[model samples]
Target chain A: MKTPGEQKDRTWILAAPGVGYLTVLYALPLGLLLLASFRLPEAFSISAYVDFFGDPFNWYIIWNTLRSALLTTAFCLLIGYPAAFALAWSKGWLQALFLVSLILPLSVGIVVKAFAWTIVLRSDGVLNQALMALGFTDEPVRLIFTETGLIFGAVNVFVPFMIMPVYSVIRLLDPRLAEAARTLGAGPLYVFWKIILPLTVPGIIAGIAFVFSLALAMYVIPTLLVGERFMTLSQQIARSYLYLRNETLGSTVAVVLLVFSLIVIVASQWLAGKVRANT
Target chain B: MTVLERLARLAVWTIGLAVCVYLMVPLFVTVAVSFSASPVFDLPPPSWSLRWYEALGSKRGFLPSLSLSVQIALISTGISLVLGTLTAIAVVKGRFPGRTAISTFVVSPLMMPGLVIGIALLQFLREIGYRDAYTGLILGHVIVTLPFIMRTVQASLSLFDFTLIDAARTLGLSYPKAVVKVLVPVLSPAYLSSGLFAFLASMDNYPISIFLTDARNKTLPIQVLEYLEVRPDPTIAAISSLLILLTIIVLVISDRLVGLRRMTDF
Candidate 1:
């Protein structure tokens, strides 16, 4: 180690190959993507950008994408929090069991998950069959090919991503904090709000950054569940390139999606920093 | 516990169990439907049979696509394990400037959308005149797999006792051999878990694989999606069940090797 360091800074030698590979592979590709958006229709023009923003339909698609993402993130948090809490508070074998169960779903491919949803959420599917059997409705509800179905599928797919981070954070939390709050006459809800929730902010922020970004740029779930009925940034990008044979338009939309993801990530990092500073 | 506390516990338990069930149902349905003799996708199935799984063998592109996915997954994972380990070592052990920045840069791919990465890579390769689809896909998967190895290996390295390497050195082993003997053994679990996850991530990747693949070479997920669009049958379910079975095997193996608790720490 000393000999290597003595030979004029071996750090660069060790780091250079991987860093260089990524620069060529990762950085260059993204740069070219950004560059492609500018090189519109064989001339240096911003028409792609102009065209994308010039249309109200495109703006609605962006808004719809954001709305779906925001809803998915919120729903994931709402559903995952208590489950993560339960997992974190459980002991030994029970905790392992829950962790195993959670990881199993996450390991399955997104394509399979979407494929399974076709059976569950389709008209005359199992969900509707059970509902009809229980007298919940006389007719099958149109859950498939809808925004609600898409969001539900997104939540199911991403909830594990939310729960795992929160669970990890909560596992390291002090049980005494909650116990002390309870001893001081705080209700369960109060204890959770004051003691547990604030401590898990970093994890929550991480989960939001992950689930929200994934939701915003999701191609599979939206395409599989709602298809052409829904138009999001990702779907639009794919359609423009694949079906329409328009590269500049697709790259422009992709750049916008990439920018949206980076914004969420940066914002979440800022929020996490503030929480850490406060604590 | 108080009555209210008990009630709260019961409620949490119910939700936890329900979420687990929700996660499993679709997969369970997929597996069940794969065993159906019915030609169409039916939940309960008119009769139970292995016709779909049998059909997988005779499907025109299924075997080739599965082979291509596996080959890409293995080769990409091998590349990532070597390069990502070196990078992780430099980031953790080297007294280098921009260590944090480089570390973040390496893992940033995981945070970005696969679709963006896919198209960006597609255009980049097209511009550079690199037309080989397999080469493009393997490289793209390296990007996908690198972060998993880097994060896990870096975490393990930070917690490792480097003194063991020095101790081995003092006992007359060369530094390289010392690292191979001591550090490698210590980080083997990290390697196994990370490598397994990375391999699975590569195999299951869709969005990245989509833009990189052409008519001659398509990954399993893209083929599966195409198959779903063209023919909605139990054959898709059969393919999915096989993939799910593969995942379960990996999960069980990883669980036995390093425990789920350790693997999910990330």
Candidate 2:
């Protein structure tokens, strides 16, 4: 057998290729991009940020991005919290079918999903046809290129994020705790509110962090479903890089998006940790 | 049971089933529309036909991109499987100062915004003088797919019994041979599921590939999105349905290999 020191020293070599590749190709590039935002001929400057936020259009873009993500998260939470229980408690073929439904949609490209929403939200689309058939509307509705439609598509795409985390948490929970509460004469509502809710806060925070962060940065869904009718940060970044060829603006916007995602991830981890420790 | 509890149970199922339908709606619509005789997106079909599917057969526009996407997906998934296996082994077995940090950093790319990564890499590639779109895409995809393999393999490796290696070794197997005989089989399921996911992630990648692809080397998703914008037709549904079919096949195979629940747990 090798010496303990030799073994310990050699062990990290296994990770060297993956770690080195990411450090060189992934991490280094991201670091350079961050540096690019502050680049100003050997002196870092806040002029880019000033120029960006000084425009009212940029503020609107930020608001539009966050608002859509917020609404999407809110909807995912409302829909997913109950659905997770159904998925967890479901039996036999139903469970497989439900699980497959979730995976199938996720596996399909976001571009395809966004395109599908476009067709569904069209003026003469299936959605409008159904509404008319049900006599809910006398005429086809203008659903496409609307904020409501964008959120509908985004929530559909992201609800799985919420359901998966919460479902996993529910699986880890001890059913007997609730059973004991019931046995002690507590109502179902009280048992759920007091016992179940607190335990799953970590999962909920995780789901919110995941869905909100993803939705905030989503490009394809917003691009295809709502198009130029709505402007979000992602589209602006793309425009700055691809069309305007303004590296300064693109890098600046990217750093801003990165900061938003970082805050969400770090905050969620801290929040989940606190909840776990407290419970 | 109390009336309140029963009502709550009913409500949960109602919402749950409804959400399932909601999730399935767009996919169901896509498949349903693909088989429709109508030229546009319509429900229940004006008539049932395989017109769109037939259209896909003769469609040469997507062929190059389709093959490029498949190639990239295969190559990148292969690369990730190797690198991720090593990384997982390191994290699981090696005594390290920053194992947790290493894992978090490796997996962070999955959670980071794709467009930001795309732009960063685009700038980096420009600076590095990455001359070919193909190699650039493979690099981008490796970063994209590596996390899935690492997470799954690490999860399963933690569950693996290292004593099996010792057992095999005592039976006259070399250390490498013992690991090959013992560890590989046990971890194959994790490898299969994670590799499948990584492949799919690569094939479905848009944001990264968008920044990498030149006019001659567009990926399938890029071409498909372009077609959707320029020509709003059921032909898009035909292509999309095929992708969904691929996903179903993947899911079923994974369900057979490792139950979907366990797969999700990783």
Q: What TM-scores do the predictions have?
A: 0.94, 0.94
Query: Which residue pairs clash in candidate 1?
Result: none
Residue A98 of candidate 1: its Cα lDDT?
A: 80
- The CAPRI classification for model 2 reads as medium
Instruction: List model 2 lDDT by residue over B180-251, tens digit each.
Output: 899999988888878877888899899888999999999999999888778777887887888888888778
Residue-level lDDT for A137 in candidate 1: 97
Model 1 TM-score, all chains together: 0.94
Query: TM-score of chain B, candidate 1?
Result: 0.94
Question: Which DockQ-derived CAPRI band holds candidate 1?
Answer: medium
List residue ranges in candidate 1 displaced over 4 A: A1-9, A40-44, A91-93, A180-187, B2-4
Candidate 2 residues lying further than 4 Å off, grouped into runs, are A1-10
Lowest summed-lDDT stretch of 10 residues in model 2 chain A?
Answer: A1-10
Best by DockQ: 2
User: Evaluated against the true chain A, what TM-score does chain A of model 2 have?
Assistant: 0.93
Worst 10 residues of 1 chain A by lDDT: A1-10
DockQ of each: 0.64, 0.70
